[model samples]
Target chain A: MINPHDSVIVRTMSRMLIPLIQLFALYVLFFGQYGPGGGFVGGVMLGTSLILGILVYGRDGVPCRAARKLMHGDGVGLIIFAGVGGICLVMGGQFLNYSSLEIPLADDARRRYLGILMTQIGVAVDIAVTAISIVFSLSPINDTEDTEPSRD
Target chain B: MIFSFEIPLLILLLLTAAGAIIVKDLISAVLILGSYSFVLALVWAWLGAVDVAFVEAVVGAGLATVFFLLTLFNASPKDTEIRRQPVPFIAFLGLPMLGLLLLFAAEDLPEFSDPKSPASVHVSPEYLEQSYQKTDTENVVTSVLMDYRGFDTLIETAVIFTAGIACALLLRRDSK
Candidate 1:
């Protein structure tokens, strides 16, 4: 079989494009406050870019190994999200009430602004990791647990 | 949000939807389905649902196609190649009936962006008017998603996490 990933054009192009895609994902994540994006959209882009990287780089490549470490990363983001909400409840306000966090540096709306940003980040992390994990488990291309006996 | 663009996009969406079923090759069907999502995203953007459009473009058109391709590739070659089978007699009668029923339902839908529409008259108006003051975020979508409805999003993230773990447990084979 002719493997497209082995082609010089495909590999070179993927290497160049992956970083650009990730940069755009970050832009979508942070600037979502002003535009048509949010944590989920940004996270998908981030995860897709990593997937593209793995596709071109192969399983033993540095990027694939790095992605392996990110497998089952569902808990990290959930903790951040719930922890922020828990802090609000602990501060004598309703759960997820951002203004109750009460930083001396900012007022109610500002506090909410910061809170939204924090939660967006948390959601983005959760989504990106979950997406990666899904692709890893669903497809053999990035499988970390199994060395496919049939391929060779 | 051009009205002229919507008709063409919707037409393309329908064609792709039909083409995905009509195509025999699994790979071709998956590719056509990706285009279907792309056209649907265009429809969403044309309808002024920019955020929803962005999501459909990325998740629907992009990752989904990749995922489908991956699954198809992992399957046997015989699985990828469809053996032609006659269309079920019930499908011919049922599909048109379903489509007509959907059309009847769609006809009752409120006009696009109608100020007095149920959605417009509901709490959305307050969300739109007060989101800036509530969250200091310029994008009300983010304000609503990450602030006003933060708990909902929190649960959604947990759901994604659960899905990830489930996939891992089910498919995380150790071929030792």
Candidate 2:
């Protein structure tokens, strides 16, 4: 009862929404400073877009190269978070104290504030990548029972 | 900002939370719980804690619901009618007692957004004043999350990773 052409239309519509969702997510990420949005919101948007891409265009629609790169984004995000702290430790300040960074700032307090926001970004990216990976792994919708026979 | 809850939004939030609790179907419960989380996020937004609201919307509403749905499919959809046990009541009461203690302690908290509250007067002030200049990042929430509390943030990342792994292990099909 479903027409092939109609399916194409549906897919196209779905595809069209991806860019809009992406833009909205970015807006949330940047606007969190002044309004109601932040890294977590932005990450969800990014993850949803990828999932939407898979839904509308199927697996092939997801860019293979991007997937490969993003697969490591979680680890990279963790490294960024830890690396920031490690730098503070080496500088003989409290772990994660950005004021200790040997940067020329009028106030060390300013540097510390910047450090915190940078870390939040890393957390957001980590969340997004991990979420995407999980979605991808579980999305085939195949039942586990198919892989084995129950004797009971 | 209007502090009192609007009738419609309150009704919607109550309905969503109730639906999450009362839904007979697992998938329906997951969906309704997601709605409840979104409502909570809206509540946070109204309170002007955009950072908290964003995290709740994404993690609590989005990924958590996804995780629940995936687990839902892993098990049978049939609802089991197990009679409620009374043992949980003790723990439940203990939780509210703890909450009450915290609430009493909060009497000392700077009233809501009072500029003089310890939270408002402490390190947060520095971040508000200097984050943009030092991080060159427009978003203060982003700067704070990534740079100032980066160590704790990494631990939180590990928690998420661990949760994902735990879910996967529990949901994965066991091999003979």
Best TM-score goes to which candidate?
1
Q: State the TM-score of the second chain for every model.
A: 0.89, 0.74
In model 1, where do residues sit more than 4 Å from their true spots? A1-4, A141-152, B1-3, B81-85
Q: Cα lDDT of all candidates, in order?
A: 0.85, 0.67
- Candidate 2's DockQ: 0.32
Docking class of 2: acceptable
Q: Which 10 successive residues of model 1 chain A have the least lDDT summed?
A: A140-149
What is residue B52's positional error in candidate 2, in angstroms?
2.1
Q: Pick the candidate with the highest DockQ.
A: 1
Write model 2 residue lDDT over B67-161, tens digit each, in one string: 67755554554543334455676888898999999999988766777898777787988998987777655667666766655556678888876
Model 1, span B95-148: residue lDDT tens: 999999999999999987789898888799899899898789999988998887
Q: Model 1: iRMSD? A: 1.8
Query: What DockQ does model 1 achieve?
Result: 0.70
